[model samples]
Target chain A: MKHQFGDRRRLLQLSIAAIGFASASLALFIFMVTGTALIVVWVGVPVVVETVVKVRWLAELHRRRVGELLGEPIESPYLRRTEGNLLDQVRGLLRDPATWRDTVWLIANGTLGLALACVAVCEAVLDLLFWWLPPGLAMRAYARLSRALLAPSEKSRLALRVEQLTESRAETVDTQAAELRRIERDLHDGAQARLVALGMNLALAEDELARNPGAAKALLSEAREASSNALAELRDLVRGIHPPVLADRGLVGAVQALSLVGPVPVEVHSDLIGRLPAPVESAAYFAVAEGLANAIKHSGAHHMSITLSLENDLLSMVVRDDGTGGADPSRGTGLRGIARRLSAFDGALEVSSPPGGPTELAMVLPCASSLPKTLPSYGTA
Target chain B: MRVVLAEDLALLRDGLIRLLEANDCEVVEAVDNGPSLLRALTTHRPDIAVVDVRLPPTFTDEGLRAAIEARAQVKGLPVLVLSQYVEQLYARELLADRSGGVGYLLKDRVFNVAQFIDAVRQVAAGGTAMDPEVVAQLLTRRSGDKPLASLTPREREVLEAMAEGRSNAAIATRMFVTEKAVSKHTNSIFSKLDLPPSEDDNRRVLAVLAYLNG
Candidate 1:
């Protein structure tokens, strides 16, 4: 009873949301029935579609509020709603398991959500002030019930995880293919062209040698320069393919070198003790670099901080910048690239950036690191 | 011209030495890695340092870093960075020093002996020589602001030529136009890019490049 009122603010907020959920579910049920009955008329289609979407929205809100009250997160196991024309989106929604799950939640949340809200208020008022009866049993029960009913079933949750893995794998392949094409294009426009020009220069030099020594020498030197340019282009292409520094110095060193070279000042702190797997290190390096690059280019930020830690067998990074915020992962390829790279490592990235100021990007990767073979070292650079 | 060379490959280093020697430029020292290159640069304090972008002992940007560090230690240290490719990012770093004695040229540019020599000489004499490829990259980067987009194609080409540290006469010769016409296009480029007008080619190149870089 005493514990129920300890977090009174959350109880009250959730009570209101529960009430909202109950009312919204009732309205949804009515709309659903009316639309079904009037299905013969084409007007019912849009109403039914809108009802489904709203039902999901309400359930999502209820889930969040309940989860907050419980002091843990309850994930919505909904697949992303497809974006398309109305009819297509309607058809897509109809076929979605989450849509049906949400509809069921809507019906249940209507009655149970209302009862839970009323019980919470009654129990709190009766017990907190008067100590007439123990409070919060109903509210606690409702919170647990919401987690049970609103969240995805184990099977569906696994299915969604598999689907996400498949999609990310496909993206990884596509990103690789796109990268290869870019390299190919770069080579075509850069070294290949220079080599061809060099060949022509050499051919001219050989022919002109008999007639004009000075001009022939000039052409010969030109040929040499062209060959040098071709070599330089190839070197750059190889560097782009794999930064040699990453191979030499490991992630920490590579990232430090990157920040040192960046236009903006970047501070790095690390509790990461040892080298990570090569692939993970590469992905993390690139992700950090991209974050830093975006801040330098668009954020107009004066200062940036990167923190790396390996605790509880989890490698986590927080990239924070004092800049014009509003970074949307969906808006640009940079953040999306970071997310995709992280997905491969079973890592996660969270971005919180409001319009007025500082942007914070937090990335968590489930990884384990071994102690360095040579020595134990630690620092904040 | 006295120069120090930093390249990872022995074959290429020897070839570069031969090429420079043929052009009346002395290669005071030729080292294959970063530390030696830096040591040579400081020891010789030559008229110029021709450095590769990649070198031994952590080859990624080794020579570029050496160049930057060298310039930091010795102001206006003339460095003609030779790379297989050129990036605007690298160009920006090279030109970060306002007192210009910088050049970044693609290795293929070395094939055009006269132009390559001209770039080396230009850098040696405290001028800027940026790669045309890098210049193109800078020019083609789409800016939301209409300033760059506002230029006519002709003016953009002139601007590219100018960014490569070309004089009005050289731009005219390349475009097969009168120097006066090139001058007019440059004026348009300068105004369109919102830069103060100038006859000094290196200063104009730096201004236009710094803007394009942004």
Candidate 2:
């Protein structure tokens, strides 16, 4: 009970302090605006500065109070300009929105805070002094009045809690639905669409074959091209969902698969003889693929080297190239997407590309003990 | 001519067999994977084998391995490996053996029916056929060499086309020139690179491959 009383007292004190500071600042502001030059220089300036400082202190106190109430640790933003020169300090003071708004709040809250403080003090004193009064005369009357004032507020609080829970659940359901829609769209637009077009082309070619041999030949050629294209597109779509090679042959084989598709010569070096976690392998594979794609398309590189190693319980990768080097991560979405993907696994990506030289991309992921039990054997066999 | 086809896709495998049969070549065996391809090669001993780059269990480099293994087994049996995409690594791996009668081409090349059939026939006859895209990649990779720097633009084109295993006639058609002019350019390219002048030999292809792989 004593602890509860002490908390209430602290809250009241902070409220009063905030109000007093705001009131003083507001009065000073009005005085300065009205061309009261003498008062502005003598009292208004100092009062404004003091009010600003006190309001900031109060805001920090309030943040701590709220954190304590919620049982969480939260740090507050505070002014820490101790080393600046006088002019810089003045400029900072003038530039900060907190300085002006807080000063206004302080000046305005002074009168309101004084009245609330007096009323609270009087109520506390009366309640304590009248402890011995008959329950029906004092305590019962006070409880009735307080209940009347807080009943509607208690009902609204319950309603707000229900609304918050419903909102959160709705958000979760919406996110899942969006993901499902995305997957469906990928299938429809990618592989299925191409297969349908291929079938149509084949039908047209078959019809034309009995009518005219020359036209049939052309149509047959188009059909063949469509079938080949559809095959390639379907292969890519299937690979996107889950590469069978990655599952069957593991990360090394997956990287080798990518290396087999690159236009430039890629030398793959790996000290990782074992398999990694599925997510880790996927992240690493995509990172290497995107890096290689960028290097080939934009770097104008002739030769590239990819190295994957396990160092100190971390899977690390480095892709380096000898090209016309100026690679900027900010200019491309590929690197940014890679960074986001790596962040999901608590991995780190670093790039070093100086102008007119070699570009290197390095990534490290923590997957020491989480590797798969058995490593698949893969070779040119 | 006799041929063995190995492709993982059932539709493509069947279509290719029909096409080969229609072209009057005997397809002795049709298998779906690299291991089966090797098995069929040993059992049938077909005159030529057409393989795909990606095959069963793991579709990475199984076909390339099968081709290399078949070459090792048969000594000089012709092999043609088709791929949807071209990679310099695979080309280097195939050319690394340096034996005669090998072909690496993009699968789309089959759309040009006459040309693709000719390529198959050429490889079966102890000759080489490579895709122009693969040859272009090889040339770009080798552009930094001092020896390659001496060739003129037209000579370079001729060299690249030759690396694709195009005969003088095909080279003439592609370059929009007469066969005599292509022959003259080929001769100049050989002499400029200090290669032996073997007119009867298909030395242009050999010269381009040497420059690209070297």
Best lDDT among the predictions, by candidate number: 1
Each prediction's DockQ against the real complex: 0.09, 0.11
User: What are the per-residue Cα lDDT tens digits for candidate 1 across B73-188?
Assistant: 98888999998656555777788877778889877787677888988887897777888777655543344445777878898777777667676788899999999998888777
For model 2, report DockQ.
0.11
Give the candidate number with the greatest TM-score: 2
Each candidate's B-chain TM-score, in sequence, is 0.86, 0.89
How many collisions between residues are there in candidate 2? 11
Deviation in angstroms for B188 in model 2? 3.1
lDDT of 1 at A176: 89
| Tens digits of per-residue lDDT for model 1, A306-360 | 9988888788888999999989889978898899888876788899989966998
Give Cα distance to truth, residue B13, candidate 1, Å: 11
All candidates' lDDT scores? 0.78, 0.69
